[model samples]
Target: MTPAAVNDADIHNKLRKELAQSRVLLVDRHPEARNFLRMTLSAVGITSVRNAGTAHEALRQARNARFDVILADYLLDHGRDGQQLFEELRQQQLIPLASVFMIVTGERAYRRVVSVAELAPDDYLIKPFTADQLQSRLLRAMYKKKHFAEIYGHLEDDAFVDALAALESLLARSSEFALDGLRLKGEILNALGRYDEASEVYREVLAARVAPWARMGLALALRGRGELAEALVEAQALTEDFPEYLAAYDLTADLHERTGDLTAAQETLLAASGRSPDNATRQRQVGHLAVRNKDLAVAEKAFGKALDRLRGSSLRQLDDYTNLARVRIDKGDIAGARSVAADLRREFRGGKGSEAAESADVAELAALVVDSLAAGRTGDAEAAKNALNAALARHDSLANRRSTAVSQHLAVDLAHACLAQGEEARAQALLRRAAAEHHDDEGMIDRIRGVFARAGKEHLGEAMLTQVSDEIVDLNNKGVLAARSGDLDAAISMLSQAAERVANVQFLVNAAKAIFTKMNRDGWDEALAERAQGYVRRAQAKDAASPRVVSARELCQRVAKKYGVQLESAAKWKKGTDSEAE
Candidate 1:
């Protein structure tokens, strides 16, 4: 807006052409500064500028209009900075996530703010820059925004697969833009459960700086491999450096639990919940852990807070409610659990409308089981089963698709109910199938084994453990030889086949090890081994340890020990280069 700059008429004409169909917001405290930006934008054939002279005016304009681009000053002459105002607009839903934010700043404070803020602005530029510099930065931001528009939209809509597809498309656009798109695409891939693809991207990014996100992502991938120690280290170190990176703390808790450090896991989660108090998911997780520890007061408080904050979020899971009910059941409040069960049924059946929400019937059934088990009522269990069947029958092909979560839950509850009625054989059959169905899900499988152990069926629990262990070992050995021969695809194929027959800790550990050896990645290996150990321990927690079980257990330990993963924290646990220890 200097006297030497291009005239307003030429700039205005440029803006008219550029922003004919777009909505733009311009906030500047000084009229000369405002006119300069306006003229600069106009010279570029952009129009549709809604001007605000102050932070108050910007907030007022945001309240009344929907803007596609926000061009604001970093140091506004108001109580709040642009960062605060930007977050306020976002909270009000007046600015969509896709809208580009450009900060015109001469202040040094904005850079420090940018370092910690999660939702980053699209671009920032110092004041008194040339028209060329502004044009370059804006064009760069615009291209990125335009290219990722579809993908961002899908993510906003919570259509994970669709967003994943958009990321993939963006990746394949051309090498010219792939570098910028790769990181985001990897994040989207992780969101979609494509860990292997995400791992590849993280590995590539790690060659530069040990990005905390990439480091944490690798740890998660390794945790999936049963590499608990390695994953734990990555998470812990990352958390130490970036305490504000709450995901690392959350991940560390999971690694702790995988290693049977329940107290450590609980502490980690509590700390994380404290750090990110506004995160509903983190609050729900704390509530869940509290319920597991039988701390009803803590569970109720956490769940209540989550329920209030995440009211409008459709993705807020029913786990918080279920855990609260569990706490009530443990406190000898059967009626409370029953009421919670009813509430679950209503929430899943009525309030839930997304595809994931459609999985509400499953929650309803679990709630019903919780209530029945607390009351020790076999008749109510049968009624609940019939109701679940009726509810599931309404969804077209829903049952077939959810053979994992829903099917096993049904079978386990039915077995628990049968046991209460003294139908030993019926209970055994139901439980056996349920174990097979949930062999891959370590959490659910442990819960099933815990039920048997608590019921005083020591021998049956050992037998089930033997069967599951054998299936996993058989699958693991099939990959073991191929892994030695450097036939990773063959190894992967064999292990995947084994996973189908049985879900076992040792098997997953081997699979994870194979992935590590072939991929050259970073994560916590000891954690993975601990998770496998947990499965075996749950089978014998309440009785005399088995001799044969110990023997097989040693063999599985040796397999992992050969790959830099010690079964326990023993000093003399190093494996030689033979890589062929039976």
Candidate 2:
């Protein structure tokens, strides 16, 4: 044999040895298929294997254990496929970046599967493939994972600076994976808000070849730098050329929204949702945009589909039911709205206890408000009045727990119902609470305005929203001014009080940032650090992906590292449900 052949043999043998030590998970609907694959793996000296018959089971196993390789068949039950499952796993961070995920499919479905997936798997295998082909692909993917391991480690720790350095080192070597390294570098730069560098990196890639991801990255970079017109042109061109690129559509929709063109945004989301009907996140976005555009029919369809797709998944939220009901009520479908309320009650009937019970109570109260709205529309005055009164009586008890969009929407709906009953004081109070809690959210503010307009109280909404905005600004400025003047103690106290008063993401993040700054400057105070951690948790619960929240977290992490303190795991700070990219 030639020298190159000999070297190839040596590398193959080493990879085989490593594969024998790897853990694998097999996912297929057919028992025989899994059995055959397991036996094939065992024949190759790979004995550590687990099997899951469905996507849900695979997710459960993935959550409990780390697997080096996951091989899933393309077709699964419940109207889902391997591609969708892979998307879910990545979105939820259930699988580490270093793991290999290969999708197995029939030859006929390969093209469709490859073209439509928003995120690609590591590799693909056609049915009736030999053990040798699987092994070769697995070895290649594992090698790439090893090559990027350092960068992945930095990313997992949220160390963007270190990750970029690692990427630069890898790129400087001009290795076979240099293109992939550039892709990752662009992502990290964009995440760090370094739009100019990101745009340059993506442009370099585009100059080399017509890569879809590179184009998408360029559009995102442009958008980040406020070059919306150029970004829209690039994104629209990508969608026109490669209609299967769903991320472009999302970016395009966001650009339209930024330009205050809700109609165009709704149209863009509608097109994307139609292409990927099983994507609950996109469906929810469609619903939200449709509602804003007053396209009730589209809103109803989008929310209904989201509820259906997320029915049995852990990702389902109470917002799904309430959003659909609200759309139905707006469409004048009183009976349809009532049916959704009934489903909500049935879904949350028997709680799991403790916090679960409290969640159930919140859902129940939300459903009551929906039903009362339906009753009012149907002229059942007595039923409407009673339900509305009961919801109002319980409102104060749950006020402090209103941290999510669901609760905010509930407050708005309750206020709308109160206005219908001519209770101006009660309606104004609910509106104030919702506005104060979500002061930084332009979408929620717009929603509150929509409710006011629908009730013929647009003038009242302007004055009330102004008051709430001013109050929040005053609260934030006082603490900021105190901190700027080097009064750390007073700053911490004032910010903490602001957080206590509103519990909004802005206030909570500010409070945590102030505490961490003080801790970083002075000696570490365990009590103060604990309070800061609490504020961070609260802010995360409200909006974990908020830039402000992320900044506060990074500050806390730096302080903890300086003090040699071992903080809690990042996973604990994540919300219970899966979150999608914006």
Using lDDT, give the best candidate's number. Answer: 2
How well is each residue in 122-145 modelled by candidate 1, as lDDT tens digits?
777777787667766776666667
Off by over 4 Å in 1: 1-113, 116-138, 144-231, 287-313, 316-320, 348-364, 377-414, 423-434, 437-440, 472-582
Please report how far candidate 1 places residue 244 from its true position, in Å: 2.0
| Count of backbone collisions in candidate 1 | 23
TM-score of each: 0.51, 0.89
List where candidate 2 sits over 4 angstroms from the true fold: 1-18, 29-32, 52-57, 75-81, 112-119, 399-406, 541-547, 575-582
* lDDT value for model 1: 0.60
